[model samples]
Target: MKFQLDEPQGGNTIHRHDTRSVWVNGTEHRNSLLVPWQGTVEDWRLTRFEDLTEAHFERIRALKPELVIFGSGSRIRFARPQLYRALIEARIGMETMDIGAACRTYNVLASEGRAVLAALLIED
Candidate 1:
Protein backbone atom coordinates (compact mmCIF):
# COMPACT_ATOMS: atom_id res chain seq x y z
CA MET A 1 0.00 0.00 0.00
CA LYS A 2 1.08 3.52 -0.65
CA PHE A 3 1.81 5.36 2.57
CA GLN A 4 2.17 9.12 2.94
CA LEU A 5 2.51 11.26 6.04
CA ASP A 6 0.58 14.48 5.77
CA GLU A 7 2.17 17.14 7.90
CA PRO A 8 0.26 18.71 10.73
CA GLN A 9 -0.87 22.36 10.47
CA GLY A 10 2.01 24.78 9.86
CA GLY A 11 3.79 21.79 8.42
CA ASN A 12 5.38 21.12 11.76
CA THR A 13 7.07 17.84 12.62
CA ILE A 14 4.73 15.06 13.72
CA HIS A 15 7.03 14.15 16.56
CA ARG A 16 6.35 13.51 20.21
CA HIS A 17 6.61 17.20 21.08
CA ASP A 18 5.21 18.99 18.06
CA THR A 19 1.43 18.91 17.79
CA ARG A 20 -0.39 19.70 14.54
CA SER A 21 -3.25 18.71 12.29
CA VAL A 22 -2.81 16.25 9.43
CA TRP A 23 -4.59 14.38 6.65
CA VAL A 24 -3.93 10.70 6.13
CA ASN A 25 -5.09 9.74 2.64
CA GLY A 26 -7.44 12.70 2.18
CA THR A 27 -8.98 12.24 5.61
CA GLU A 28 -8.73 15.22 7.94
CA HIS A 29 -7.10 14.45 11.26
CA ARG A 30 -6.37 16.45 14.35
CA ASN A 31 -4.21 15.42 17.30
CA SER A 32 -7.33 14.00 18.89
CA LEU A 33 -7.66 11.22 16.33
CA LEU A 34 -8.03 7.77 17.86
CA VAL A 35 -5.22 5.31 17.34
CA PRO A 36 -3.68 2.17 18.77
CA TRP A 37 -0.10 3.21 19.28
CA GLN A 38 2.39 0.38 19.35
CA GLY A 39 5.40 2.32 20.59
CA THR A 40 6.55 4.13 17.50
CA VAL A 41 5.99 1.93 14.48
CA GLU A 42 9.26 3.09 12.98
CA ASP A 43 11.32 1.77 15.85
CA TRP A 44 9.35 -1.15 17.24
CA ARG A 45 6.26 -3.31 17.22
CA LEU A 46 5.37 -3.13 13.56
CA THR A 47 2.48 -5.56 13.27
CA ARG A 48 -1.09 -5.73 12.07
CA PHE A 49 -3.99 -5.51 14.51
CA GLU A 50 -4.97 -9.06 13.67
CA ASP A 51 -1.52 -10.20 14.72
CA LEU A 52 -1.66 -8.61 18.13
CA THR A 53 -2.02 -10.79 21.19
CA GLU A 54 -2.70 -10.46 24.92
CA ALA A 55 0.95 -9.57 25.45
CA HIS A 56 0.50 -6.65 23.12
CA PHE A 57 -2.54 -5.63 25.04
CA GLU A 58 -0.48 -5.74 28.23
CA ARG A 59 2.07 -3.44 26.71
CA ILE A 60 -0.56 -0.92 25.63
CA ARG A 61 -2.11 -1.22 29.05
CA ALA A 62 1.14 -0.14 30.65
CA LEU A 63 0.83 3.15 28.84
CA LYS A 64 -2.25 3.85 30.92
CA PRO A 65 -3.75 5.73 28.05
CA GLU A 66 -7.25 7.05 28.46
CA LEU A 67 -8.39 5.59 25.18
CA VAL A 68 -7.20 2.93 22.77
CA ILE A 69 -8.06 3.27 19.10
CA PHE A 70 -8.13 0.13 16.99
CA GLY A 71 -7.82 0.81 13.29
CA SER A 72 -9.31 -2.14 11.50
CA GLY A 73 -7.74 -1.07 8.26
CA SER A 74 -10.16 0.80 5.96
CA ARG A 75 -13.06 -1.28 7.19
CA ILE A 76 -14.56 -1.60 10.68
CA ARG A 77 -14.74 -5.35 10.98
CA PHE A 78 -12.67 -8.21 12.38
CA ALA A 79 -12.36 -6.87 15.85
CA ARG A 80 -10.63 -9.26 18.25
CA PRO A 81 -13.22 -9.75 20.91
CA GLN A 82 -10.63 -11.23 23.22
CA LEU A 83 -8.51 -8.11 23.07
CA TYR A 84 -11.60 -5.96 23.42
CA ARG A 85 -12.49 -7.79 26.59
CA ALA A 86 -9.01 -7.34 27.98
CA LEU A 87 -9.16 -3.61 27.35
CA ILE A 88 -12.63 -3.39 28.85
CA GLU A 89 -11.44 -5.25 31.88
CA ALA A 90 -8.75 -2.65 32.33
CA ARG A 91 -11.42 0.03 32.06
CA ILE A 92 -9.72 1.72 29.18
CA GLY A 93 -11.80 3.66 26.71
CA MET A 94 -11.73 2.00 23.31
CA GLU A 95 -12.89 3.04 19.86
CA THR A 96 -12.84 0.98 16.68
CA MET A 97 -12.85 3.09 13.53
CA ASP A 98 -11.46 2.81 10.05
CA ILE A 99 -7.73 3.41 9.65
CA GLY A 100 -8.30 6.78 8.03
CA ALA A 101 -10.62 7.90 10.76
CA ALA A 102 -8.36 6.34 13.34
CA CYS A 103 -5.49 8.53 12.21
CA ARG A 104 -7.65 11.62 12.42
CA THR A 105 -9.05 10.70 15.80
CA TYR A 106 -5.65 9.79 17.24
CA ASN A 107 -4.29 13.20 16.38
CA VAL A 108 -7.31 15.00 17.77
CA LEU A 109 -7.21 13.17 21.07
CA ALA A 110 -3.47 13.42 21.43
CA SER A 111 -3.63 17.14 20.86
CA GLU A 112 -6.30 17.46 23.53
CA GLY A 113 -3.81 15.95 26.05
CA ARG A 114 -5.82 12.79 26.23
CA ALA A 115 -3.81 9.60 26.39
CA VAL A 116 -4.50 7.75 23.16
CA LEU A 117 -2.93 4.98 21.08
CA ALA A 118 -3.61 3.84 17.53
CA ALA A 119 -2.99 0.60 15.68
CA LEU A 120 -3.17 1.46 11.99
CA LEU A 121 -3.49 -1.83 10.14
CA ILE A 122 -2.56 -0.45 6.77
CA GLU A 123 -3.07 -3.53 4.60
CA ASP A 124 -1.79 -2.80 1.18
Candidate 2:
Protein backbone atom coordinates (compact mmCIF):
# COMPACT_ATOMS: atom_id res chain seq x y z
CA MET A 1 0.00 0.00 0.00
CA LYS A 2 1.03 3.60 -0.52
CA PHE A 3 1.60 6.06 2.33
CA GLN A 4 1.37 9.83 2.58
CA LEU A 5 2.27 12.48 5.12
CA ASP A 6 1.25 16.16 5.16
CA GLU A 7 4.60 17.73 6.05
CA PRO A 8 7.98 16.87 4.64
CA GLN A 9 9.99 14.16 6.33
CA GLY A 10 13.62 14.85 7.14
CA GLY A 11 14.50 11.19 7.25
CA ASN A 12 14.00 8.14 5.08
CA THR A 13 10.32 7.48 4.37
CA ILE A 14 8.58 4.25 3.56
CA HIS A 15 6.51 4.94 0.46
CA ARG A 16 4.82 1.59 -0.09
CA HIS A 17 4.94 -2.05 0.98
CA ASP A 18 3.45 -5.44 0.20
CA THR A 19 4.18 -9.01 1.24
CA ARG A 20 7.21 -9.29 -1.04
CA SER A 21 8.64 -5.83 -1.48
CA VAL A 22 8.93 -2.46 0.20
CA TRP A 23 9.43 0.89 -1.51
CA VAL A 24 11.61 3.32 0.39
CA ASN A 25 12.68 6.66 -1.01
CA GLY A 26 11.29 5.42 -4.31
CA THR A 27 13.59 2.39 -4.37
CA GLU A 28 12.23 -1.13 -4.31
CA HIS A 29 13.77 -3.45 -1.72
CA ARG A 30 12.75 -7.09 -2.03
CA ASN A 31 15.21 -8.30 0.57
CA SER A 32 15.05 -7.71 4.30
CA LEU A 33 16.29 -4.25 5.26
CA LEU A 34 17.41 -1.97 8.06
CA VAL A 35 15.55 1.30 7.57
CA PRO A 36 16.91 3.85 9.95
CA TRP A 37 15.56 7.29 10.79
CA GLN A 38 18.06 8.88 8.41
CA GLY A 39 20.85 7.36 6.38
CA THR A 40 21.35 4.85 3.60
CA VAL A 41 19.11 1.83 4.07
CA GLU A 42 21.04 -1.34 4.93
CA ASP A 43 20.23 -4.88 3.86
CA TRP A 44 19.33 -7.17 6.79
CA ARG A 45 20.32 -10.35 4.83
CA LEU A 46 17.92 -12.97 6.24
CA THR A 47 15.12 -14.08 3.94
CA ARG A 48 12.96 -16.18 6.26
CA PHE A 49 12.05 -16.06 9.93
CA GLU A 50 14.12 -19.14 10.68
CA ASP A 51 17.24 -17.57 9.21
CA LEU A 52 17.18 -14.95 11.91
CA THR A 53 19.89 -15.18 14.56
CA GLU A 54 21.19 -13.17 17.46
CA ALA A 55 23.62 -11.44 15.13
CA HIS A 56 20.69 -9.89 13.30
CA PHE A 57 19.35 -8.33 16.47
CA GLU A 58 22.83 -7.23 17.37
CA ARG A 59 23.09 -5.42 14.06
CA ILE A 60 20.00 -3.40 14.93
CA ARG A 61 21.19 -2.83 18.46
CA ALA A 62 24.41 -1.37 17.10
CA LEU A 63 22.41 1.30 15.29
CA LYS A 64 21.19 2.65 18.63
CA PRO A 65 17.67 3.60 17.60
CA GLU A 66 15.33 4.44 20.47
CA LEU A 67 12.86 1.89 19.19
CA VAL A 68 12.90 -0.93 16.66
CA ILE A 69 9.98 -2.08 14.55
CA PHE A 70 10.69 -5.70 13.65
CA GLY A 71 8.67 -6.78 10.60
CA SER A 72 8.74 -10.50 11.17
CA GLY A 73 7.84 -11.29 7.55
CA SER A 74 4.24 -11.87 6.39
CA ARG A 75 3.22 -12.98 9.87
CA ILE A 76 3.81 -11.77 13.38
CA ARG A 77 6.36 -13.78 15.31
CA PHE A 78 8.32 -12.91 18.39
CA ALA A 79 12.01 -13.63 18.64
CA ARG A 80 13.16 -15.36 21.80
CA PRO A 81 14.43 -12.80 24.29
CA GLN A 82 17.87 -14.38 24.34
CA LEU A 83 18.21 -13.60 20.66
CA TYR A 84 17.93 -9.93 21.47
CA ARG A 85 19.70 -9.82 24.80
CA ALA A 86 22.01 -7.16 23.49
CA LEU A 87 19.14 -4.81 22.80
CA ILE A 88 17.55 -5.44 26.15
CA GLU A 89 20.79 -4.77 27.94
CA ALA A 90 21.12 -1.53 26.00
CA ARG A 91 17.55 -0.55 26.96
CA ILE A 92 16.40 -0.29 23.34
CA GLY A 93 12.68 -0.98 22.87
CA MET A 94 11.38 -3.24 20.14
CA GLU A 95 7.99 -4.24 18.76
CA THR A 96 7.11 -7.09 16.43
CA MET A 97 4.37 -7.17 13.80
CA ASP A 98 3.53 -8.41 10.34
CA ILE A 99 5.54 -6.76 7.58
CA GLY A 100 2.65 -4.59 6.45
CA ALA A 101 1.84 -3.26 9.89
CA ALA A 102 5.49 -2.73 10.70
CA CYS A 103 5.96 -0.71 7.54
CA ARG A 104 3.05 1.55 8.40
CA THR A 105 4.22 2.06 11.97
CA TYR A 106 7.74 2.84 10.86
CA ASN A 107 6.55 5.51 8.48
CA VAL A 108 4.45 7.20 11.12
CA LEU A 109 7.24 7.22 13.67
CA ALA A 110 9.79 8.33 11.08
CA SER A 111 7.54 11.12 9.90
CA GLU A 112 7.15 12.32 13.44
CA GLY A 113 10.96 12.48 13.75
CA ARG A 114 11.24 9.58 16.18
CA ALA A 115 14.58 7.78 16.38
CA VAL A 116 13.33 4.50 14.98
CA LEU A 117 14.49 1.62 12.85
CA ALA A 118 12.45 -0.84 10.79
CA ALA A 119 13.96 -4.34 10.66
CA LEU A 120 11.88 -5.87 7.91
CA LEU A 121 12.13 -9.54 6.96
CA ILE A 122 11.01 -10.49 3.47
CA GLU A 123 10.03 -14.10 3.17
CA ASP A 124 10.40 -16.10 0.00
Q: Could you give candidate 2's per-residue lDDT for residues 29-107 as a string of tens digits?
A: 9899999998889999998888779999999998999999999988899999999999999999999999999989998
Tell me how many residue pairs clash in candidate 2: 0
* RMSD for each of the candidates: 9.9, 3.4
- Maximum-lDDT candidate: 2
What is candidate 1's local distance difference test score? 0.54
**Tens digits of per-residue lDDT for model 1, 57-121:** 66667667778776666568656768666677889987877766766677776555566777445
Best by TM-score: 2
Error of 1 at 64 (Å): 1.1
lDDT values for all models: 0.54, 0.91
